[model samples]
Target: MTTSSNSPPLTPWGAAIITGVLLFLGYVGFDQFYLEWIFLLPLLWAIRDVRPRRAFLLGWVAGIVGHGGGFYWIIQMFQQFAGAPLPVGIVGLVLLAAANGVVLAVWAWGVSLLTRGRERHLVWIAPVLWTAIEKVWPEVFPNYLGASQYKVPHLTQIADFTGVLGVSFLVVYINATLYRILACRFEGKGVPWRAAAALGVTLVLVVAYGEFRIREVDGKVAAAQHLTVGLVQTNRGAADLHLSAGAIQQEHRDMSKALLAAKKADLVVWPEGVLSLGLPSREGTIPTWALGDLKVPLLFGACLQLNEEGETRFYNSALLADASGKILGTYDKTVLVPFGEYIPFGDVFPVLYAWSPYSSKFFSGKSVEPLKLGPHLLSVSICYEDIFPTHIRKLMRGGSEGRTPAVMFNLTNDSWYGNSTEPMEHLALASFRSIENRRSLVRVTNTGISAFVDPAGRITSRTGVWTREVLVDRVPLLEGTTVYGAFGDWIGWLCAVISLGAITLVTVSNRRDLTGKQNAL
Candidate 1:
């Protein structure tokens, strides 16, 4: 790609800083999502005339600042959850931001390599590389560029077909097109109206499709049966100095009783790990007092310990109980949080556990199964498991009966991050599960952002942070699955394959060119 002799007089570092800060603003507090559409312009323009190595460095610079700012809460998270000191927490955040930076660095390098001879293809090439790299790159907290647009329902409805990465693809596509237009003007060339027109048409079609789908999904939700669910948020710390296990349990029971007194509810849910004592995994072992006077079915997070022939196993689980306190079913959390729940490779290197003394050692659940409450089958996710789209799809896909989930439930404890944007961000990502599977999601968290999201990805009701709230809503029980629930991130997988092919071709071409030059020499 060619740069103008009279282009904007900004240095590469200046451009990187602008892109990075804009990206930070687009995702976090004061979320100006529109900035996401144009944030990449500066970096893309700066890298147009640079070598691949320089482009990669520029990309890393922008990524470090952007990711660092967006994920600043990591410091507090480590401090609270891991009990790490300030210096250690700061170092952890730096390492995290640097690691995430590598994804963008690869994208910039790939774009520079691909556009060596073909400059005009930047519009498509950049977006494809960006989407592909972001898809394949693994992170501690998995998120996509599309998540920034979570509040914008019209732009997010396409997730039912292609998942969140599809939304990321479209956002980058717009950025690349805008960059192309601006680059043309800088070089004193004619504006690429055809490219602009293509972008406009694509957006129009996307919005139009979103409009149609929203209306259709809303109709489906209206026609479906509704379940009155009560969500209890206790506003207690993850490990409070004052509250005892019995006291915490009492708080939930009191709130639940108030809900029953006001209106009837089919189910009442509590956040993850509220019950500190490990309940033995045996029939007739569930404490009757746990249910108290409420006659309704109750589901709450607890630790279950099973003693087999000669060993003991601990599970982070959600146990469902009948009106008389009979244990009906249990859905153990399948996707355990790294470090928070269990150390990665801790068993192999036992010393790692010694180094981080607070890390948990719980085992992952065996399968994804929905707990049945009467006739309605409830798909359950504990804590951050709801953030994973494919995992949720598997749970909602049904167990042996081949019947989809009537309603989805996520029991989470957000007290780990305190009063930060983490809860809000978590809510944003979890809301898509309802849209993809066309089920109402009832999320109950310990320290706020407890919400009810409908099939249209609309936040029906939500509670404030650090507040004790008893949210009662008639959550719709949906029946059908969308393309995403059935197929599972097919678009992202396709993009990854394309990216691998492109990287292979580029490497082969570079090697052939080097061989020819050596022969000439």
Candidate 2:
């Protein structure tokens, strides 16, 4: 009896873990794209008619297992690059997993509260709840649920206006509809036409939007000005910094020279921090022409340190140079990485600052600045800055002090993730930024998946992973900004507002019912 009492809860634990596996198969991974449409069914079934607390626990398990599985590469990133101890890296991953699991736990709690001891019509409210949580999620390191369907062009078309939140809502709404229909059937009740109708209407609208948007884009692309842009993938990683920068610079020069000799490009872009070692001054007697003197201009990322007033300042900078090797202009990187670039809350906790790989703090650029390159000006984003949609739009806006660019350039180095799904995931999320602004995006990565993405979020030219290559493709420069650019993330805000308003109404209704019943008794 004493031994049995000391034993752990195997049955419940097993159920939770199993639910997580189901979620993973249904989400995204290794040719499981078709399974996404029905992924939530099993998780919903397991927690069906369960106590609110139990449901929340199950949801947390499923969330952690599924989401963590998608981003498991994070552990390798922490251990290998961030210099975290193996045990510490695992702990950090577990903590991240727990944080993600909490999002689903809260979602499950809402569902259980709404359906407990009452008709489950409120199950359809899952869309509202999901969109609300995702809207406020920090963009510093964003991972979207909708990114799972990135390969499906028709589904991603609506992202221009609704952003990724619209896609996430559609996914959850479908799950809710399926669960409700099945539950009603199991209970020997008539079919819920209202829930089915809502689901059908939502699908129809989404499909219709895709068709309309694609038609408009096709017409514009047919008659647009096509400019040849050269993208060089250095086949390098951040770890390569341990080696001398001369060899790395030589590789870039050789690649660019070969591509230029083969087909002359109007503009050439290199990956983030590709020229970190240092380039000699253009005015110096022995000036370095890394890419050789070409007809086309060059743009590349580097770290620039200079004195401002009495102090020294450091910047993650992108420099644009003319064909004659004259420095045109420089765009400083804004939206610096939290712990990676600078230690967060380091002033209060000095130990955290001491733990960083670098001693100097990188100063964030205050405004968006576009670089002039012959016929077109290019809006520049460095490293992880493109991940934030809001920040990207500000760069496109050309505010009062800035000029709008004909094209957008994301100089990134996703090589940090090694050979992982993160590179592809980042690519998918970056696509939306192009559609939202209705401008062509030139994404040049150090390793692979370097491509020319059109205004429609379609990849016209892309290179494979872990390869050394250069992609020279004709990309159309789109005119006029998208509605999403003018007014950003309105749909996300609206959905959040609707969810809060509905919750308030439900709480008031429940209280009124309780009061009436008490008086009658």
Candidate 3:
């Protein structure tokens, strides 16, 4: 790790910095241009000639740079939207980005140790190790690099069986292959034509498979049901959302009236946290009757409290009601938002609560069961839950049992990001979930991008942003499961195993070569 005087020096530390910048640029560039993927190359490059500790540090730096740059708008979400002060909001964003970066840093450290002297082969090992890390790392900032691929339908077809992990694996592997070819050419070493060829073949296969799946799913027309769905978009900003108790209740009432007047739809949906006033099940709390007159089974989001064994538990929940405004069944949000809903390791980080929006502790749901509504079985996804592909598959499969459920419902409030690309990005991810599970998704949003996506990831209908509008559309209730829904995330697991096995083989071969060299000396 030294440099020349005549030419610009490339120290290990300098390489680390370059790695971070390149990774950040790659992510930002890909996201802005929709270039499928390019971020994985920098991870391989960063650890190409580094020790384990340095590799870990480089990876961490790269992760922070990439996430911090890509999701910087999240700070606006915390400050202008969630009503936090500017300094605290910036710190929260940095903490989140760094925390996510730690996962990649660990992966780099592990791979560097395994391939100490065999840096040239990092192009093969780093991607697989990183993919495995991303797949198994329990929901600490669950939205990773590949999660952004939800919008690229052609590439996301692989998610059917592998979930999002499969897409991550493929993207990293492609980047690794490209890096290998370039490195070989740069050093005057013979080009790794095999790596280049393999990459080309894999791309073709992915594209071909995606094309086939698209055609197959598109050809089968869903028998359009006559059921009319009314989607309510509140268009309320974060400041408006956190108004006084009386004002909050009044807002819910006005939104309810707008939804009720929209049409005589069979089912009406509301965004997440529309009724943040209080839980309806709690004592002295305003009931659903106070909101508006309902004519059908209304599925709306609210904070609810349930008593179990004389103890009251509060939840961010979605409740279903009949035409007479009688409560039917309630679905508590199963996958809770990390810092937003409940802080992780709250025992250790007591001060974190001061920055959160909730005044009290939030309880997570015990199950991912679908609520029964007349003849239809509905699976519910609250806010960020829609981004997790496996969660949706499990919900649909668990709910469907042996028969196909009527539809999937998502209740979300994207007002956190205000008027940015976040809302559109969120909608794009939801579309992939719909396609992957072969189900129609009905999304009701607080701010904008409320719409209906059919089984093939096509937006059948949508609403304008920052507008108080109710959209009624006839959506098809899909029957039968896709290959992804049936098999779950086994494909991703298999890819991960293969990746690990490759790393093991490379490490063993390199170790043997080192031993032979020492003996000869």
Candidate 4:
């Protein structure tokens, strides 16, 4: 009789462990196809029997599996492409997976603390806290959650103002609602049928609103002015191009001819460092002969030297020029890629800089501001900067002080990843930004996925990867900002504050109940 009683108590615990493992595996499987929605259901299942410590542990496991599966290609890049040994490459992959896992662990712990013992009500705390953590943790892993939501155009419209955190908030809320229903059932109580119904209604309302917004934008695009853009995709490997100065110039000339054919184009874009040499200053590294032949407002990626005080600083920069080849403006990439551009804490640990062949001290741009191009105000994002939704939001807000920009320009070199799903993933992210900001996005990538995306996140036209080709497309110059653009990350911040407050209140209440029971004893 005692053994039977003990077995009944252990049943839920065993079920919980099995459920968590299944959920982790589910997340990994879904990530293979980049179908993020599948993991949401399993995540809800795992959180149903949420003990604080168990929640944290389970979340960490899910995160490791999910990220390790999705970004396993990083291992291939390190070992095969970058030529790191097998063991070192594996260790690098593990470290990146662990770092990503930490974010989910923190999120799970926060949710557990907020919802502890209150397995009764449909607590709205988890979603808000999860969104808050998703927004802030990007300071560490800048290219994670928001970038993953690129394929969901209907949901990504919220990113213009709130950035990707807004989409994350909705996704988490839906999962939380699902968890609430399961928890109610587990406790052998009548299903909190009202809460479940409310959640369903809320989702419908949000989707309807998004559909309406998309329709409205579609109608406006038909009447809007269109700009012809020339995008250049140079299929050159970074390592192989370091051969000769003359060979590099010939490559740039060939790539430029592809763009020059699109004479009707208002803007011409080149991928990052298409010109292997640095930009010409007043002192002039590029001769007067090279400057005279340029046509159209050419935006090309190159390295540039900035003289500040007595120091000469080198920057990964985008140069803007007119038809006559006169330089107009230059935007340096502010958010530098760690290890790729410059080593982190290289001054303290110089040995770490020896890991990569690139410069150990590449400089970062000071501002996230937009550049002025003819009648249009343009926001220029270099390479991976397009993946960070918040940084893009700040750039848009800064540019739209009086009027919003006609379009957003992204200059990138995805050649490092070669012909892989990484480029497709990168394109998906750029498309989300286009829908979010209600602005046309023109992405010029080296070695493929060069395309134009409308404000509705539609890929109007694109070129093949690893192909040396020019893509010319007309994109609508959209007006009107999104709700997410206007508010910034206030929604995420509010959720975090409320979740923390709720946790504090619950902790206090639990302590009081414990005191009362002790006194009674």
Candidate 5:
């Protein structure tokens, strides 16, 4: 047992609330990332002696508060994207909480199931269970627990080998160790010296590895060739706004021209959907005058409308054009945002469209190829696609020379989220892709947070929200794949497999225990 069986149990509601607030502060309102290391301790301690059902309830409550507060911008998103009223937006937040909150619920239930009588094993069980749940459980926002440490580059450098889950594992392990030490003191039990030593040794190794990688990556950055690119933020509002296509295109044209006039760039990039035109099939369809007479190659986002099998489909895509305004190549976004981009099962149940009148009819892209411009093989992700590590990795691994994209580019329009924490959170999550792939990332967005991320996941030339700004920077054109890029989230997968096996064994053991008691009775 974790605590003395005779000791009185503490109420869990207060602990759950404390943990929930810590989670919110850690990831959302405050920038105190240190809270992430201890956010789960309160919840873990509260649930140590509780039954699985009560444990799940406490965990779900904490998750609901955490996710609801962190994603409060979802209310504004519903208002802007779906034209929902304030009450509907509130409902959306509640629904989001209830849905994504299951991650914590299952995690708590799994912990209670595995360590019912052996609660002392929480130091060993909690980290793997949390990691596994995070890996398998789907989230609309894919906000990994490790992303909170993005600001602490030293702690985040290990992402190259183990992905973000590595950092999460470390955070949970620390919390568990600290909780165990505290629990022992409360119960008047012997100190857990082994757990403390293991934690100290783990921290030492992680810090050493982080320092070594930072030095190595910094050296590589200094020695690598650089690409001068111009990033343009148009400050346009949501896609459904009163802004006309002509106005949008003209803003991009003006910005691109101003950037080129001020400084020379190998390429100038525009935010997603700035062009607002169907990509022309034949050359010369996009007149030279349409590109603002810029002499350099332009990489911009546009809609690719195709008619195949007697059906018309629209795709969110990025297109490359040379100085002469001739089409070079195109990359379609393979991942589509549900409800925001297209309604799931809307075709079979057409009435679903009535509920979400503002949703788009865009189809998912079929390709993940990068557009080529001279020596630069630019891997492009449209909108929120950059938020998914696996998708970005696959895009990097695309082409005959697999995982050889020299640079990563993301064309996003974050106007749907308004001026909220969503843009910053989005930027934070997307930064990991740079470290995971060991490649420079240039993110251009409509209505702000446009910046350049180095191979080390450091942000440069960051622009604020709702601003019309032009940022010109020399970003490194990095090659070669890191361990994470080559192998993907192996650690997450291993933890998931372990969690599954543990669940199986626990179920069988519970059944046998019940059967033995029944036979003796």
Candidate 6:
């Protein structure tokens, strides 16, 4: 059971499988969710008294199972949209899961050191390290464990100040504390009062803060001037594989027109990549569409191809068109989705990807700018770009004119995910941005879950999956910056620093102890 053992107890395969399955059940990943506190208990138990390498392998297996299970929706997406073979899509899913497992392997080794040896006192550092690891998790596949708790509003409001890292830390802290208590019990220790008491107080403050935040945001939202925005979900996505670009554009235009029959909206939004033809969309031009007959400004996604220095570059752009059919501004998505948009390291290692999808690259946007929508300015995120908190903060910070947007819009096309759980999961992760910035957020998707989220991170209006509907609602736009809105990624950075300090402390202590033991001998 010594921490310096080169070989220790081997973890059974059953333990790893159980740990991963439990972790998967705790994710927004599934149709039903289980208690997150119990998710990591098995892994901690499996790794106890085991060598660091064995612990790492166990954790890696758990991660592979959990990640692959939670993100299985990706397989359906690839087959539906990318025209990928069933076997190829499955392989893609496994590859992604294995890639993410590396992070868990390191975490497993760190946890072994933290929960064992003379440095076991650093077990309390678990939450900090967990948050830092989440921040390190691939931005392309953003399924942070904290997102699963979005349904629990009381625990979610803490995201306002610390961003999602705070909620993630809290959840991980509970898991760590519970694991510690169980480990101590096995060792004949009654209880870890110091760590337990600290965790108890932290939970108390988290709940208390959530209540105060809810009350404060309610008052501000009630008194604030509301903007009426219409979200159009045309139910036209790449999944169908039959709808031509022109047909998709027509469906969106028809839906928007039908929605106007109810009441005029200040601004109308479309899902990303909905605009194909019937408008001057391709060839880097915005021609007049049937939407020109309407008296409201339109914001929608388009595929823009332009020639730069005799070289052609394509972009996934969200363009604004006035009622007069004049082009206003186009916000090209700066943060593109990996694999889905472009392959990572495709330029450096060309031979790595012979896949056709990886061959085409969409040029990244240099800047993120807010588009004008009637009297209020709107910050837009195309596709998966909305999930990045750092990028959303830049919008709140405003452009060179310092003209901050009162509303934020996320244009996404999730139909490729099919009837899977991703639409809701994606929505949950994006909701944190609303609270972080204290701005009204709207998601206009190609298929379903089109919603309007208030500054409190509450979903005021939402549509069912695969529904073709237009959501017309009043969005409460709160002014002024929030604590997290002003300080971007500070919490994640702080957790990273804490993790490094913990590692150093444990490593140095272990080294000194070995030296002292040798001298005594």
Alpha-carbon runs more than 4 Å astray in model 5: 1-10, 239-242, 280-285, 401-403
**How badly does each model clash, as a count of residue pairs?**
0, 0, 0, 5, 1, 1
Q: For every model shown, what is its TM-score relative to the native structure?
A: 0.95, 0.90, 0.83, 0.86, 0.96, 0.91
For model 6 the local lDDT of residue 326 reads 73
Lowest summed lDDT over 10 consecutive residues: which window, candidate 1?
1-10
Give, for candidate 4, the lowest lDDT window spanning 10 residues: 26-35
lDDT tens digits, residues 1-521, model 6?
A: 22222333443556677778877777875634446766777776777666778778888998899888888988987686555789989998898888877666677777877667643454456677778888876645766777778777778888878998888888878888877776676667777888788878888888888889899988988898887888888776664424486676677777788888887787888888765333333323344564535667888887767666567778888888887767777788898766667778987986645765523477899766687666677888887777888888887777776777888998888887988888988888898898888888899888888998887788888998988888999887667888898777787888888888878887899899999999999
Q: List, residue by residue over 238-293, the lDDT tens digit for candidate 3.
A: 55765754565566566656766756678888888766434436233234565566
- Across residues 1-521, which tens digit of lDDT does each residue of candidate 5 receive? 34322335445767777888898789833668999888988788778767788889989988898888888999988888777898999999999988888888888888888988886888878899888988888887788888888888888889999988888888888888998888887778878898889999988888898889889888988988888999988888766334587877788888888888889999999988766555335234467777777888888888768675578778888888999888887887788877877889998998988988888778777776778888778898988899899999999985766648888999998998888889889998899998888888899998988999988888867999898899999987777778998889898899999989988999999899999999999
Candidate 6: global Cα-lDDT?
A: 0.77
RMSD for all candidates, in order, please. Answer: 2.1, 4.4, 4.3, 4.2, 2.1, 3.3
lDDT of 2: 0.74
Q: Tell me the spans in candidate 6 whose CA falls farther than 4 Å from its real position.
A: 1-12, 31-34, 118-123, 137-139, 239-242, 277-287, 290-292, 345-360, 515-521
Winner on lDDT (2 vs 5): 5
Q: Kindly give the stretch of ten consecutive residues in candidate 3 with the minimal lDDT sum.
A: 1-10
- Candidate 1 lDDT over 154-245, as tens digits, reads 99899899888888889888898998898788778879999989999999999999999999988877887888889899888888612577
Q: Which residue pairs clash in candidate 5?
A: 397-403
- Stretches of candidate 4 above 4 Å error? 1-35, 38-40, 47-50, 76-84, 120-123, 143-149, 182-191, 244-249, 277-294, 349-351, 354-359, 399-403, 514-521
Greater-TM-score candidate between 2 and 3 = 2
